[model samples]
Each structure stands twice: as structure tokens, then as C-alpha cells.
Target: MSGVVFLILLLLGLPLAFTLIASGMVYFAQNPELPTAVAVQRMVAASQSFPLLAVPFFILAGHVMNCSGITKRLIHVSNLLVAWISGGLAHVTIVLSALMGGVSGSAIADAAMQARILGEPMQASGLSKGFSAATITVSALITACIPPSIGLILYGYMGNVSIGKLFLAGLIPGLLLTLVLMLVVYLQARKKGFAPTQANPPSFKQILEAINQSKWALLFPVLLIVTIRFGIFTPSEAGAFAVLYACVVGRFAYRELTLSDITTSLSESVSDIGMIMLIILASGVVGYAIAYEQLPVSLTLAVTQVTEQPQLILLMALAILLVVGVVMEGTITVLLLTPILVPLMQSVGVDPVHFGILMLIMVTLGGTTPPVGIAMYAVCNILRCSTTDYVKAAVPLFIAVLALVVVLALYPPLVLFIPELLF
Candidate 1:
């Protein structure tokens, strides 16, 4: 079966895109009744979506802002806001992630960026290299829930859910995470003697100056939501607006973006978009095969026969996803499994948007964990920390993330309240 081959190739360390393509090809090859051309057609059709255009546009906007000095300004604002706390840099890291999530949308990108930006400062302030690396990688989890999140976009696309709803759905959870992680850092930092960076919270003048400087970066998510809510822009159009907004902010407001920066952002976005879009295209073939197999229907009957309780069935699926996330990248997991899982949950009366947040969290959480955690490795490599130390440092944060996940899972309203109110 394609699933079996896909796992073997994955264990053999095949690239995710190629592994998807290969498994799809194997599926077509064996099923002589279905022409091989269908797989190719599926891949081609997958990336042709209009809602899907949000991925590239948002990606380019993120890259543009990255080069335009927006990141540094936001970091300054984060410091002004939170660096007086115990484990101040750690708190700042968490808060900055909440802020940056709106801008970057990519956890791996935010993690790598923070590990590079904050790792040294954390170390200089007496945080261990491993702790610094772990903080950045784990905090990137916050980014996975925030608006413009590529994972959410992909889930919305694959699951036939509203991307706008998904965006609003994430706002509260993302903020909740910011508070929870900061509390964890506060307690640990107190016991560990990780002192505050400042004597007190910033003066009003300082706060105003920081916000004034970074206001453009901060206003982006607000602008995105308003436009989408009022029908001023579709999600796809919102993405286009995101790109144009970033360009304006970079060139005029910040006066930091040069022609060279524009060229660099374009080059970076081309690479980033090509990589994500290709994987998406390859996933289309696998998704088509799953649909052709009636996998969701089969899962529904199988799960129903085992237990009809909605919560228990949902738990089982979440458990499977949590486990698989450790082995697979998040977006690939979303693309490959959303079709199969969304229907299963719908049958059980679990709200897909609720599950979407929980699912994205679990899947993205894996990227911050284990042997295959790309975000973990990225941060560790940047900070030159050993995998062993990173794991040890991550235990408490991992527990915090998992705990929040349980809360989100048990209380659907926590995830759904915003979407319900907005839409």
C-alpha cells in the first residue's frame, strides 16, 4: 500500500515532497484502473487554488519585513514591554513570538530568526545556550496558531474550512500561550536566579517610543483581520495586501528597505514559496488517493465501531497525530492527513475549527521536539547547543505546551469562541 511505502521511504530519510510524490506514483502504478496521469493532474491542480495564493503572498510579506528592519524594531518593543521580568529575555522571547507570528507565519523561520537574534543575549544574561535554544524553538509554537499561519491556511484549504475563521480562532489561543509560557519562564527564572534585564518596566516615554517605532509591524494582523472581516479583501487578496503593505512599510515608514532588499526578499520568497507550494502540489496527489480510497469514510466506521463517544474518538486521533508529528514535518502532516482526519472529527460532532487549532498545535509542536524536530535542530545548530541539553531544557516547556493542548481539547469553546463571535 502507498502508506506502507511512504513510511519506509520516510524512515529512510527521503525528502517529504519526494516521498509524497513517490507514494502517489506507487498508488497509481498498482491501480491499473486509474490512469497514472490522474496523479500528475492532481499535483498540477493542487497549487492552482486562489485561496492558496495566500501562502506565497504571506510568505513574501514575511520575507520583505524580515529584510526591512521590522524584526529588530519589534524585538526592541518586546524588550521594552517584558524584559524587566525575571527571566526577562526568555519572557521577551515568548512575547516577541506572539507579535512576530502575525508577520512571519512560519514557525521554523521565527525559531531560526530568534535563535540567531536572542540566543546570544540570553547566554550573555546567564541563560544556558541550551535553554536559549530551547526557548526560541518552543516559543515558535505560538507562531503556529496566529493569523497568517501557513499551517492554518493549509488546514483551511485541505479541510474546506474558512481560513478567516481559523485566523480568528487562533488569536485567543496564541495569547493564552504567551501568558502560560511567560508564567513558566517566570517561575523557573526566579528559582534559577535568572535576573531581570531592567530595574522596572519602561518609562511611558520609552514605551511610546518603542511602539511608535514598531507600530507598522504591530498593526499588520489588525489590518489583515479588518480587511477580511469587512470583505475589503478576500484571504487571497489580504495576502496580496500583506505583500504591498510590507513593501510600503519597508520603503516609506521604516526607510530601511533598499532596492537590494527588495531583490533579496523576492529571491528568498521564490525559494520559500517554491518549496512550500511544491510540497503542497505533491500532497495533492496523496490527498486525491486518500479520497479515492474512501479513507475518511472507512475511518469513520472503524472509529464508530470501536467507540461512538465523540471525545474519546477525538482523543485517539489527537494521540495518533501527536505521535506522527514527532516523525513528520507539520505542514506535510496537515496536507497528508487533514482530508482523512477532518471528516472523522466531523462525524463525531467535534468542531473542525476547534480540532484545527489543536491539530496544528500538536503537529507544529513536534517540530520543536525529538530527533526529527526541524525547529529544534535549527535552534540547537544556531546556538551550538547539544541535542541532549536542548531536550533537558525543553522538558518543562514541552509539558506546558502539552498541558495547554489538553485544555484546548477539553474545552472547544476556547478555540471556537472567537470564530463564533466573528462569523
Candidate 2:
């Protein structure tokens, strides 16, 4: 009954956090035998987590970096390295996103940022509005997999997996996605006769200068992982360090950060943090109700009855996520589903960290897709491209991503290798 209400409320366009809270209240209303206080208790308990501190700090750091002129430097670096490629600006979009992954950590944020900065240039260079918007939006998927990813942090918090391990796990997959998207851009650009942005390759000196200028930005993720892996800081503390690091880099190294920037970053962080944490808290009620009902146990039993194969079971879960993702926002989906699916995958002998990467990617990818794709709307709106045109241009890029997803799904080591080696 609560599930049906959730779906109905969601389809009616109620805010996700409110929908979750209301549905949770309904669940309690439906079961008067249970104490009503449980719902409030669950909501409060959700906010008491220590590790959940990572979300706000990282979000603050991302906003700080964006304001500090870090994004501009990375964009400059990306253009230096990739602007001579056949698809020039398209490749720049992919590389910039790969670089932004460490800085932004949110796919929608990355997509909007890129669309604002790169979209006009791509179209002016003769790329269609649809293709440009599609490229910018799809490239943001790299942000979903990279270190400091908020989705991974939430998955780690909810599933009780190591946040550091999940961060490491995302590194290889993020790079792989970058390469795959670049290839797609190259082929598509060639077919469309899209010329290079630069006639000549960057000189060795230019490459060195570019990297030197952005070295601090590039080093952040590496430092984040090392500190966490070697016990220098907990993930929460690493987040604090991230904020400090961004401030110092922006204010001193780049000399682009200002007092006003810090104030703006704080303001933006508060809103982003509030929205995400509220959804998480609301999910606590739903989570408690699900647990009280032993939903994981029942679902695991039901799934295992159909097939014991871990890969096949994972495929089934992915399919379901794909469908759900089209309608729900990614963060909401992650919060609502992680508690249920993590245990189900664990029962089938799937590594939670491995599954986490796949799950985050699929859910985040959902935002680039259909009727309720926030990222899609964000990018398309910025580029002034229609949804129909964007979808048509995004098909090949989507195929590339789906193929990579299948490969990662079949081969667990690809996702787990980095974390295992470091830890």
C-alpha cells in the first residue's frame, strides 16, 4: 500500500523528499499496531550518522572549486590536450568531464556546467544542438564514477561498505568511460565531418604548462584516496580536507577565489546538502518499514528461487533500476533502493563495492535519459535543444555506455582491482 502511494505521489510530481515522508507516514497509518514514534525516530536516526558528514563537505568543496576558477583551468587544460582531435570540441567535452569528475562529483552538476561552458562553442563550430547537448550530458557520467562522488558516498553510508574502497573502485571505471565516450565522439564527428578546433597539436611546453597550472586540481582525488587508504583521515575528515584544499588552491595557488566566492559556496552547499540529506532522512522511515517487514529476506528468497547465478541476478536488478531510474531522480533512487538491493546482491555472492559502481552508474545514467531526466533537461535547456533531438543524438553515446556497463558487470575485477590493490 505504501509502495503504491509512493508511485502515485511520484507520478503526480510531488517532491521526492515529501513523497517519501508522506508515504512513510502512510505505512505507519496502515499499521496502527506499530508505534507511530518509529517514523520520527527513524528520520532522526538517519541524520545521526557520522560518516554521512562527507556529503556536505564534499558538496561545499565542489562549489568552492567551481567558484575558485578551478573549472576554467581544467577547461583550458582539456582544450590544450584534446582540441586537436578530430571531434575537437566533442573530445574536449569528454576530457573536461573526466577532469571535472574529481571536482564536481555530481553528474547533473557536471552536465549543466559543461553545457553552459561548452555547448555554444560546439554548436558554433558546426555541431548540432542535439549532439552538443547529448555529448555534454553523457560525458558527465564520468563524474558519477570518480572519487568524491556523492552517490558513492551515500551508497557507502547506506550499505556499510568502505567509502574509500568505493572511491578507488570508481577510478578505473571513470577512465574507461572517458575513453569509450571519446571513441563514440570520434566516430560520430568523422561521419558528420566535424573539424578539429585546433589545426595543430599542443606543443610539449604547452602541455607541461597546462598540467602545471592545473596540477593542484588534478592531485585532489589522488590525495583523497591516499589519505583515506593509509588512515590519514576518515572519509568525513577527508571531506573537510577537501574543503580546505579547494580554498587554498583557489585563493592562493590560482588567486581566483574571493571572500564573496566562499560566501556563495557556503550558500550553495547549504541548499544542496539540505535537499540530499532530507531525502536520506525521509528514506529512513521507508527503510525502517521495509526492514520491519523483512523485505530483503523475502525478496532474496524470491529472487534466488528464480536463479542462483550472481551475474544473471545482477542483470535482473540492473533492468529494474533502468526502468525505475527513468522516472525517479538518481539520488532519490539511490537512497530508496540501496538498502534493499545491496543485501539482495550480497546474498547472491556479489561484491557490494562492485555492485555499487554498476548501480550508481545505471541510476545516474537514468538522469540522461527520458521523461524525468533532470540532467537531460538541464543540459538541453542550457543548449536550447529539444528533448526529441537530444535523444536522437544521444543514442550512440548511450549504446557505448551500456556496452561498457555490460563488460564491467561480467568482469568484477575490473571495478574491484584498484581498491583491492590500494587497500
For residues 1-423, could you state the per-residue lDDT of candidate 2 as single tens digits? 988999899889898899999999999999999898989999999999999998899999989988988878888999989989888898898988777663454678878878888888988888899889999988888888888888898889889999989989998999999999999998998898889989999999999998898999888877988999999999999999999999999989999999999999999888888888899999999999989999989999999999999999999998888778778777888888899999999999999999999998898888899888889999988888999999998999999999999999999999999888878
Give one digit per residue, the lDDT tens place, for model 1 in 126-156: 8887778888889898988988888899999
Worst 10 residues of 1 by lDDT: 100-109
TM-score per candidate: 0.97, 0.98
Positional deviation of 314 in candidate 2, in angstroms? Answer: 0.8
Q: Which RMSD values do the candidates have, in order?
A: 1.3, 1.2
Candidate of highest lDDT: 2
Instruction: State the lDDT at 255 in candidate 2.
Output: 94
